[model samples]
Target: MYLTQGLHRMLQMNPAALATVFRGRRRSYGELAARVARLASGLQGLGMQVGDRVGMLGLNSDHFLEYMLGTWWGGGVLNPVNIRWSVPEIVYSLDDCDTRILLVDDNFLHMAEGIASMAKVRPVLIHAGDGPAPAGMLSLEQLIHDSAPIDDMARGGNDLASIMYTGGTTGRPKGVMQSHLNLWSSAVGRMAEHNITPNTSVLHVAPMFHTACMARVVTQVIVGQPHVFVPTFDALDVLRTIESEKVFDILLVPTMLQAMIAHPDFGKYDISSLKRLTYGASPIAAPVLERALELMPGIEFQQGYGMTETSPVISISGSENHSAAGIANGRVRSAGRPALCVTVRVVDEAGIEVPRGTVGELIARGPNVMLGYWNRPEETAEALRDGWMHTGDGAYMDEDGYLFIVDRLKDMIVTGGENVYSAEVESAVAGHPAVAACAVIGVPSEQWGEAVHAVVVLKPGLEVSSEEVIAHCRQRIAGYKCPKSVDFVNALPISGAGKVLKRELREPYWKDRKHGVN
Candidate 1:
């Protein structure tokens, strides 16, 4: 169950096999293992003790993979910072977890100063980019080159492996604490159901910081397959990488998949080697799925459904459900049955099981379920009750045990594969001087699956333009969290209890849609 066990196995059985390929830089298993060992030793040399948190604020790269394994190998927990978050959000997350070592890449070098100044305890900044280390930052290459290789710490089982932060309902971020066993169970369970083809390389287009992609990294490591990476998702780069690297498997959000398929040069590359494609984070539009099937004939398609708290996998709709017959039968809309490692049940507010076909909160129990929310006992108790993780998602189960998600009970928005809490956006929107009140909701989006929309009521005798409102939010929150559209209204729809009626506001945008979510 150790995270580094797979690496050890590869080193013993196939040390010479290709381990990673990143933009002209490739490494064998033997080389990667040596680097990970040295990186672990370097962390130890920098006074990183067991159970200390190490954070990385960087885009996707082979170095990101090393940092993940290196931290665990040195007996430390991981805290992968969201690259899209504003400086304040990044600082809050780092401070919340008491992360002492922070890694920054070229893309985020400008933010390092802000983060260091704002964080409660300044972290040791390590430059993880390919370029030379900037002033006041330690070079990752230098550390690995100078330090001696260390032995594996062998921390596993109930040991805390990562503290992934997700958008919070209370206008903050909640760290989901996952154990090594939790992650191991998830990857193995998924691998058992959707077998990875032997000797096939998996492309890493999705950001490695995300749970979905990180879970894939674990699965690939367990199978001892080569990993290919691009800094971020670019349609042409993905196509070119697949052609050059012979990438056989990939996981993408519907938005990325749509962009890649809709690219003008899509047919210019030889992607015949691609075997399986998995999509999730948000539901896929039928047209996109159909077009993908048409363009890439014989490729297996699977849709996964889960969140960070469940080690990111709860159910999977396999290739069978993507077939023409399945689509015609309406089974393609399902989130699929319970995963192999999970026990799922739809429950009422009182925790009683609901009848099949009735939408209720989705509850699951499994080793893959996260241990708890870090340092938030009350929230942890509320989410995990009686040995079941009560997912705040509105969904229904059918007679055949398939789950169909209809709405988000927590009022979270999934835009372009990123989760944005309405409360967080509303808080920012309300900060405007001319804004007397505001409510944020997720609206249907053709490209992003969902877009954040803000409905506002200006203070009496005050006026604010939509552009002004959006510009104000940009300063307070991440650009993705900023409202894509702002509606100036005299008053927002309200319920008897005085809470803003978000459903009413969302109705116009989501009307006639099969599911409330995109």
Candidate 2:
């Protein structure tokens, strides 16, 4: 179905209901619907034709949501630029996808100018921030107020909805083509796995540019839930918002969750309204999960597992899977079963389904699978082999069909003759009492071809020696999988989405080597 159908339904059925809350500003469904339509008309007037690529470069906000809906509402495709990318990287994506219209907030307004100067075809910039538009940029407010509201374009099914660029493993970003069916299936599939109510108030803290959070936004739209937006994630601000707004649901990365639970003033807020906490991008450490459960006794936790190519939701570890019952059954450690619309299999290089407990690539087949990569047909064919999207993530399925992701196939360390998944080592290292965070990677080794190397960050005022870290891991996992060496760091290099960037960690070590892997 069309993405804007939910908005249309909301306007007809509950126009007076609260649609969004951002920084003390609240808009009713009627107001939001009208603004969205007007914004669509404005973009149309600015030369956005059907299936034209439109870009948004900004932090999360109510305006960001409007841009998303308004783009599809106007029968256009979205190219949401990653906020963390440099001018050159952002320019590459825009140039690659031929994004002609770019939306910028206060943070990226200046960068927008830089992008415009460098691009072959300078884009039309729409300012979507609080202040007035700069000299050349179009004001978002002016557009909505001046333009007449238009009807939804009703684009659906195979229509291209978004071209989401993911940071490429090979150092160049690739645009993932997500159709309307891809996004719709993911949103509705997730809703089927959760207990979303009419009164569900979802707090969107993660960057809207990421597919994980955007998928959540679509689900909230379909359910007609009130949305609360924060420009960025701050531990104190998150806690305060939860208390003040009586928010019911939130999505966070494990690192963000760690900071929130560790905040000294966490107990000061009355957060009983919080009922659901959904996390993804990385697996949660046992300590972090235990602390979260202890702190928020009644909250149901869900772990979503997927990447940008699958409209970002493949499997979901539901509330029960995070509870005592499921944990005892070994489901908590799993990525959970496939989503309502997805079919998951652990396949070998030959694309044959491996026996249960055999590690192989986790391939998924579903309507939620992306249409293809933009302008990368060879890569697209390589990824979408046969009918399944080969996820490049190394995982194994148990007898119960719960998928346990080991590591990225590229990130797996081949030491001597054995394959050592980095996640296995990281999980063991994280269990250390003094460890705050850790990432494991493969380093060059004359003896073993590639050695397991662990980079760790300890809790403040706490220390653990490299020997101790290795010794701890030895008790939990195999010696080959254990770190042969450890380097203690103040912090791990993390992506904007809170995942430890292993590629960055391996870069310095692998710089002199011809190949990426040892």
Candidate 3:
């Protein structure tokens, strides 16, 4: 069961079924397949060979899916660029993956020029959409229209399917190699655990570029359900779509859920259409969960916990525990058990298993594990050991098999379902002249799960203010990674190992809770 195999199956078994609803326009499976075949032929005609990498840079569109399937149909690897990265970051990722063909949308067309300007090797460009192609670049639609239909490339299991770049908290982004088998197994396994079917109408509120939304799409395809794509998540837009489109399922981060429930007009929409809700970018606030429960009763809530390396699904807590857990029966706070066909164990630094309910590093082993990080063997080997993907999450399993995430092993800050590494933010913050020392950590937020909070010791006589510090970091990193709030401290507590004690920083906000976080 390769990743591309589903497209062929859908084209054959359910040609007329709705595949994607984008920007209020719907595309049927048959129409999408025909288009994908044409695009595949066009790519093959452009000297695309088996195993060559093709890049995609764009917002969510019907064409994104078309190009994705077309790449695999043409026996190529898909390397979707992160639209959030700086120009240099984007160019480095493309060059690292050795991408020779790139498809760009209107929003990202300027990036093509940047890549051409910097990359030692420039890829053939194809502009995505109805617009005319830029200088020296062919329009994607024109290429598809002029080409003959081609059969599926028929790449089998374990074949390279994609090279997704995961932006690290420090240093450069690493390309996580994904195989057809990894993607297919992840999709099927998630649907199995969540009991998704063709009857499901999964909502795509998150960006498809991110692994969370991308992985969710696979299950919807496998179950042959229609996925409603929203280019980005907007609280009201999500509510409107839920009520209007009757979205049966949605996968969001805690921040998105909080915003949806807290929206002033949240009660305006009839959101009973939601059958299952899966969220797990970060820990959920108890208040948000209670409010969501109050608004939408009888809703199935599930939480999935994993990183990009684990094909993203390590464990899932579902309806069985959503409304009930222990004697509480429906406690929806837990992140559930290890997924089907997945092995999860909490381990210490020595790779020794910890006792049940003891916090430690979470390790997962399954077919869903990524192949390796592209061009970084040392880092890849460090992450994947003994056939298990080491998920750098601080978590523990209860006697009931439910997992609770206490913190992160890598100081990763998950806000709004997006990961913001402190190391990355620290690098930016360190550049400022006003700071003597700084530490970035997650603090409980009403909107975002754990907002980026920075504790800084300013140099003597420096005129830097909290706003100025955040403004400095914002210019260097993405907006989401910038600190939402700041604390001026005389000094940050350090442990014997010379590590800044995050617990000491986190205690003030979370000391009253049973756990360190809400």
Candidate 4:
């Protein structure tokens, strides 16, 4: 079934049930369905053809959900712009995919002017904000009010659904092509593992731009359950919302959870309604997990592991793996076995399966695998060789099929649940006029799983401070991708072929660490 089919089913089954709640506004299934239909018709009327890519740049909100459903209902593809990306990065995605129609919230209206100027063809803007429509963009509310409901296009099964841009190894963002089937299989497989009830209410604190959070959203829609949205992740807001809204299940990164439990006023909130807590993007520290368990004795904790190429889930560490015994026995450190619909293998350089507990590249073949990287056939072939997605994560599968991530085969840093490629950071750092050479590496961090660290060699007679280097990189890339710490050197160690030996630079920091990432 298509993603929007569940919405139709909900309309027929429980029209009066709560569908979405954002800020203080609530919408019943009946109201949401009508608005979604008209929005779809309105999008089509504004020149969205079948298979056309429609873009949305916004935070978590009811409008963001509506934009997602309406785009699919109108038979168009989706491109969820990363909110952390700078103007140049956003424009590159819009231009790369030829995205002509864009929906912007009040938070991103300021970027519209810069995006319009940089893009090859200025997109047709639709303002999805509470305030009045800006100069040249059409009002989202006006579009819905002025249009007529249309039929569902029924796009499903291998149909191109989304083009999600992810950090790439080649110093640029790679658009991951996800089909409807890819997303559908991921959500259904996760739900089967979780066994979420139809009455479940999920809180959306993670950004919708992320595949992990989007997977959660898809599962909630399939089960026809209520969704509670907060504009963004805040420790106090999450605590208050769980108490007041009675949120049943919520997905968060370990960092957010750490902040929530560490909040000074955390004990003041009556959060007994929270039943399940799902976390992913990076491994959780033992102390953090122990504190979480101690604070919420009745809460079930789960962890999922995968990348954007897997449509985001290959294996899941279940609630059972979070028990006191499981944690004590070290099962909590494992990424868990394959999901119900996925096949996972740890393979060596010769493309052969390795012995249990032998570190190797994790490869997966499943319906949830992405179609390929958009417009990069060579890169796609390398990643999807032999009909399996070769995940660049170095892992070892135990005799019991529990996967333990040891290192990243590719030099990618995952800070606070965001992937920051070393090449991207290096490129940004090397662009500074004062620098001659640079190498980026991931260093262990308590707050972030890994923080991006940069080593630089300045040009002759040139000087640059660490803060200045960080500020320079921030102008060119996202803040998370910038170096958390910088070290100035006279010269970098290079091999005969002129490649910087990043291993030498990384060895000191990871000398005593068990895992490459924290």
Candidate 5:
């Protein structure tokens, strides 16, 4: 049940097999295992304890895999920072979790100093980039070369494995604590649903910090398959890598899939080797799904649905649901049945199970569910009630046991596959000096399934333009969480309790949409 057990199994079964591929670099299982052990030793040298949190601020690469395995091997928990977050946000996470060791790649090296300066405890930085280590930082290569190989610490079961931070409703990030068993159960459940082919290569185009992508990483390790990585999601790079690497599987959000299919040079690549395409983070539009099926006729498309709290897998719509027959029957819209390890139900506010076709909050109880949010006992209790994780998502279960998500009860917006809490955005918008009051809502968008839109009430004498408001928000929050558009209004509709009526603000934008969410 230990996360690093897969590495040991791979070493015993196929030591010389290709384990990781990134850029022009490739590492065999033997080499990867040895390096991981050495990296574990290095962590111990840097004062990492059995339950210490090790953070990585970087892109998807072979080194990222090493860091994950090495941390577990050293008996340290993972705290993979969000790359899109600003330095203040990053510092907040590091400070919140007391992360004292951070690995930074070239893309994030510039922010390391700022993070270290702002953090309550300045983290020891390890350079994980391809180039030479900069001044005042330890090199990842040097650490592996200098340190002796160490045995796996064998931390497993309920031991904390990762502390992934997700957008919070209170305008901050909440660290979701996932145990080794939670991750193992999730990966195993997914494998049971759709088995991976032997010796196949899986592409890592999605951000490694994300729970969905990291779960796939664990699944690949368990299956002992080759991992092919791209630093970031670029349509051309993904197509080229698939053709060059002979990739068998990939996980993408609907937006990334659409971009790849719509790319002008997409037809030039020989991507017949790809066997499976798993998409999630947001529901795919029918037209986009149709186009993807038409473009990649051989590839099987599957949809997964969940949150960071569920170890990122609650249900998965199989390839069959994406088929023409399933679409005709309208089953394609479902999030599919609960995973093998999970028990899912739609329940009312009173915690009673609702009848089929009744819209209610989706709740799940499973081994894969996260332990709780770090340092937030009250919030944890509020989310995990009666032994079931109350997912703040509005969904309905049909007679066939399929779940259909209609809205996000938490007022969370999924724009370009990234969760943006309306409260978080509203807080930033209201920070502007010219603003009196503001309400943020998700508006229907063609490019990004849902775009963050803000309704603002300016002060009596002050005025601010849309661009100015957006610029102001950029200083306080991530770019993705900033409002895509802003509308000046006299006043927002409010309930008797002094809360903004978001539905009224969202109504015009989602007028003809069947679901409240895009």
Candidate 6:
């Protein structure tokens, strides 16, 4: 099924119903559909053909969505540029995809010009931001207003829909190719699993370039839910929106949540209107969860677990699992039951299934799994084999089917010849009163080959010593897994998606020298 079919259905059901509220502009499904259609026609008129790759470089905006959906509607593949990436990183993705039409917002106007200089094929430029379009670039409004609506679905089912570039520890980014079917089923399956209905209003705070948040947007369209969009996430702005706009639900990573609650005016916001807060992209500390519960007793926290390749959702720890009853034990730490359409298995090094309660490599098989890695057949074969997508994450399932993510297979530390899941140590350290956030990494040690190191962030006005931190962790976990050394930072490095950037944290220690991790 075409992913854009929701737009047509929404327009038919309620032409006047608000479909998007972005940057003080409200567009009903009727308005959104018309713009999307005309924009598709505009791209087609500009020589875009079926299977052509179209690159969009911009921050979150209505124009970005219109351009993306329009490109897909015209049977072209979307290549959304990561806004946080450097010029070279952006160039790599665009050049790798062989995209020829670069749709740029004001923020990237200059960068787009620089990219144009290095492109294998000269790219046609379309400007898509407020005020006057760039002098040398084609104006988006001009293109849409001058063209006729085109309704064509040349690519469907397993056809390439979009290519998302995820961070590559391999020294270069890899494009994960997702099909129309992959996306549609991800949206439908997640919606069905979460009970996200027309009455639900999802806040768009995470960057649109992220497949996790973008998939949520697609689901909103299909369910005809009103989406309240923000230019970017600001904790105070988010609280204000919830109080004034009565936002029912939102999604964010744990780091974002930690910052929000830690904001000075956090207690001042009226947040009783919120119902579900879906958290993912990183693990959340139990202390943060406890504080959030105390501050907003009415909220239900749903934990999401996935990587970009699985359309970013393998399971969601739902409302029932977030209850006070579930928090007493370690149940709150679980990532919840797998989504209806997904099958998860914890496998050993030999590719044999591990029993429940045994930690092993997490493998998945579902429609939500991507078609393959873009233009990398060997890599694709390696990633998607034996009828399952290997997640490269170590995890286990309880008898009740609750998934517990142990650690990334690459991130698991081998210290003193003992296997240690960094997540376990981080979770324990995070439970301490003085610790606000932390990252556990393996550092070089002459004695142990690799020693466990903890980089921590403490609560304001708190005095904590590295020795005390080590002692606290030592009591909770094996001494080998506990921090042999600790560094107190005001904040840990975080990625564009808001997850703690463990790789960046480890870079200081491992940059000039190398260990095993690729």
lDDT of each: 0.88, 0.91, 0.79, 0.86, 0.88, 0.84
Give per-residue lDDT, candidate 2, residue 428: 90
Model 1, TM vs. native: 0.81
lDDT per residue for candidate 5 within 1-518, as digits (tens), equals: 99998889989998999999998899999999999999999999999999999999999999999999999999999999988778998899999999999999999888989999899999999999878999888999999999999889999999999999985334578999999999999999989888779799999988899888999999999989999999988999999999999999999976588668868899999999999999987555555667688888878888889888999899988988888898899888788889998999899989999999987889999999999999999989999998899988888899999988865776878899987767557657766778767778888889999999999988788988999999999998899999999999998774321235676788788779977764
Worst 10 residues of 5 by lDDT: 494-503
Off by over 4 Å in 4: 411-518
Two-way TM-score contest, 3 vs 4, winner: 4
lDDT tens digits, residues 1-518, model 1? 89999999999999999999999899999999999999999999988999999999988899999999999999999999987778998999999999989999999999998899898998999999878999989999999999999999999999999999985434588999999999999999998998878679999888888899899999988889999999888899999999999899998887688679878899999999999999987655555667788999989999999989999899999999989887898888789988998999999989899999987899999999999999999999999999899888888899999998865676878899987767568767877778766778888888999899999988788888999999999998899999999999988764211235676788788778887853
Clash pairs for candidate 2: none
Instruction: Summarize candidate 3's per-residue lDDT along 1-518 as a digit string, tens digits.
Output: 75666777787898898888877888888888898899999999998999999988887777887888898888999898887777788789889988888888888777778887787688888899677898988989899889999888889588988888875544788999988888888878877766765755778876677777778877766667787877667899899988888899998876578668767898888988888787776555454566666677788777787777877788887767656342275335567888888898999989999999887888889998999999999998999999978878777788877887755665777788877767567656756777766778888777988899888887677868889999998898899999998889888674311235666787788767664442
lDDT of 6 by residue, 268-344 (tens): 98877788888888777777877776776778778888888988789888878778778775788898888989998
* Candidate closer to the true structure by lDDT (higher is better), 5 or 6: 5
Residue 179 in candidate 4, Cα distance off native in Å? 0.7
Task: Score every model by TM-score.
Answer: 0.81, 0.98, 0.80, 0.81, 0.82, 0.96
Q: Which residue runs does candidate 3 get wrong by more than 4 Å?
A: 324-331, 412-518
Residue pairs with backbone overlap in model 6: none
Mind sharing the TM-score for model 2?
0.98
Task: Give the top-scoring candidate (TM-score).
Answer: 2
Model 2 CA deviation exceeding 4 Å by range: none
RMSD list, candidates in order: 10.8, 1.2, 10.6, 10.7, 10.7, 1.7
Best by the lDDT measure: 2
* Stretches of candidate 6 exceeding 4 Å from the true structure: 152-154, 512-514
